[model samples]
Target: MTLKIDCQLRDLDFTEVGTHAQKMEEMGFDAAWTFEAGQDAFTPLTLAAAATKNIHLGTNIAVAFGRSPFAMAQQAWDIQKLSRGRMHLGLGTQVRAHIERRFSMPFDHPARRISDYVRCMKAIFDNFQNGTKPDYKGEFYQFTLNNPLFSPGAIDHPDIPVYLAGVNPRMCRAAGEVADGFHAHPIHNMSYLKEVVLPAIDEGAKTRGKSVKDLHVQTMVLIAAGETQAEIDKAVEDVRMQISFYGSTPNYRGVLEHMGYGDLGKELSQMMRSGQMAEMPKKIPDAIVEQVAVIGKLSEVGPKVRERYEGVLDRVAYYYPIPKDAEIGNWKAFTDAVKHTA
Candidate 1:
């Protein structure tokens, strides 16, 4: 399969999204994604839809429990119409603490919850498009009422694609069972993808009489790329920090343990609890850094990433902290290199 390059809109300002998305489309990006961090993920896509015609718009992940499935379907439905069926709805069940403490929402049985969530959304969309009865009853979410007065009737594009984000096996399997695609976490290595993620997804796919080939697989890759040696070193340092941060999270411990970094993961979590953030990155060995990230100069990054993930991923985007401006102007060279190389 030909690997497609994807990009992210990191700027919180919604005003600049249209122009940035326009540039991404012009530069030949297959899609642009937004994540739920400090701002709403849907608004930017709405703007991007009006600005670009062919480029796909999606949420890298919008928190699933943060809103009702019906509400999310409505937003995605509108964007699908605005973009003429180019919207992809990506959803994730955030960790328990965040869902309970932060969002103040229930977060039990995440794997099952998300599975039902996707089903509910599909049923709601079916009702909107085909006037199919919105009778979906699942373990977590149940939606049987859809008054026509509240429904956003049929449109040219009603079959919106749903992608689910996950790291653990259960969640990965759930995604394969229902979602149109799976979004791999950025803090992943090829070993974890091959040994754990793919197998679990395939297992879940089997339950549905499907396989990995039936779904789109995509991920956010950690890349340490720069034009100069000093710049490359700086990027590596940044990547190290990211790896350390992810390693400290309990949810991501499986990837570390699978890579023979179980002890390192425990140490990082301890350091995090001790408020020793400055010391965590220094503890990540060069071996772990190389395994988790693609390190090279700007010119070499495109080919190296393509070579590393060509058969493993159907699509990928470079993962990093988005600068304040978050314009695609600086990334044109990198984007061009990937397309030309492909």
Candidate 2:
């Protein structure tokens, strides 16, 4: 199977998205993804459409609870129209605290609710694309009205692919049942993907009478790589810090445990709760880092990534590019190696 290489933009700024997208496409990347943390995901992608062609654009995840289905559909549809069909709608049910406290939105039964949300949005999209009256009723959401004057009917791309990001089985299954893809969390290891996630997807697809092959599985993995040992060590430190920060969040304890670092996770969470943010990174041992990340000479990354995810993954995106200042040749070499092997 040919594994598609995908990459996400740095959260720092999006002013150079067009320039970056052109460069990424030239470097052989199949797609560009953006995340919504403190910024809007759709806007940067909309800007990217003005800059390049061919590379698919998507939100790695925009909060599902933050917007109504109608609003989400409207935004995704507009981007799809502008991109001439190169758009993917990725949704996430972020934790209840962020949804309720940060966004001031209601949150409950995320799996069921998001499943309902997807159905509602698809129903809305169908109504808009087919000029049919809207009448969808779900446990969590209902849409019974669509006025012709305000609705912009079908475009060239009416079926924008939908992907959902989640760490639990309920979400994996839900993605299989209703979404076109599953965006695996960066912290996930091969064991989790093969033992937990794949089974969930299979079960969900079987329940829905859908083929597992119909769902694209994409994962972003931690990387600590460079041309030289010094560069590799520096990148390793950065990834260690990031991994520790993630482990400190109790929500990810299961992932750490899957990597046989359960105690490390507990300690990190305790430190975080006690406001020892500076000490958290120091707690991540080298072994834990090695288990959760792919660290080696830059030349080894592509083959190792391919070895780790060859059968289970459809596409892979790195947590971040290594040797921040490395020449584009480094990235080109890495991607080319994977392509030739695949």
Candidate 3:
């Protein structure tokens, strides 16, 4: 299968949005994404939609538990309209601590909660599309209020594709049950994906009389690459820290276990609880890094990524680091390489 390479803007620049989007589109990259980590996900895409044509845009993940279903539908509809139906809204139910402590939201039965949430959001979208009153009721959320005075009814594309971010089986299954696509967590390796994630999603789809082919599987590949071997080595070390951090999360330990590295995860979790951040990466050996991330010289990453994901992904996004103050954006080579022609 032919793969479509996508990238994300690390920094928000309204003035340079078109300049960047136009350049990426010309570079043959298929799409662009924004994250809800530290900034608003749609703002960058608002500028992107105004500036370019043809390139798709999405949120890598916006917190689903943080907002009401109607709010999500309204915002997603606006993005889809503004982007001319190029928006794919990606939602995620972050872990309980973040939900309860950070967002002050409840976290329980996440898979079932998200399933009901998506159902409610779609009902809202359907109401907007069909110009009817919102009359959807789910166990988690309900949208029964509708007034034409405030309703921005009927857009060019009411059915914006909804993708869900998932790392574990229940979330993966939930995505297969209701979402248009699945966003594989960056902490994942091929073995964890094959052995744990996809099979659960397949079963979820099967229960609904659907199949794996009905959902787009988009992976965020963690890679370590640079112009020189030294830079590559540093990047690898940096990514060991990243993987270690991911491993520290109890939910993600399953990935480490599936990869035969359960002991590594246990050590990292202890270090994390002790707040020994600097010493965490020391516990992750190079072999573990190799299993979790792609490592190569600048020219080699594209084909290598394609090799690893050949039968698995329909779309892939590269997540790596390049110094902002450097003379050139090192991620350029990664984008070009994944395009498979550079």
Best by lDDT: 1
Residues 89-112, model 1: lDDT tens digits = 999998999999998999998998
Tell me, what's the RMSD of every candidate?
1.8, 1.9, 2.2
Cα-based lDDT for every prediction: 0.87, 0.84, 0.82
Which residue pairs overlap in candidate 3's backbone? Answer: none
Q: Over the stretch 1-342, how does candidate 2's per-residue lDDT look in tens digits?
A: 788878785553567667777777666777888888778889888988778889888889888899999999999999999999999899999999999999899999898999999999999999889987788999999989979886878898798999999887888998888888899888877788888887888778886788668899998888888779999999898988898888887778888888787798889988989999888888887877777789898788889887787778898887783223446776787877766542
Give the candidate number with the greatest TM-score.
1
State every prediction's TM-score relative to the real structure: 0.95, 0.94, 0.93
Backbone clashes counted, model 2: 0
lDDT of 3 by residue, 1-342 (tens): 677788775574567776777666665667888888777777888888877889898888889999988888888888788888899899999889999999998999899999999999988888888866678888889999888876778988777889999888988999889998999998888888887778878888898899878898897878787878899999899898898888898888888888778787788888989999999988888788888788888678888888888778789886742233433334455566665656
Best first by lDDT, ranked: 1, 2, 3
Error of 3 at 67 (Å): 0.5
Instruction: State the displacement of the C-alpha of residue 219, model 2, in Å, after optimal TM-score superposition.
Output: 0.6
RMSD of 1: 1.8
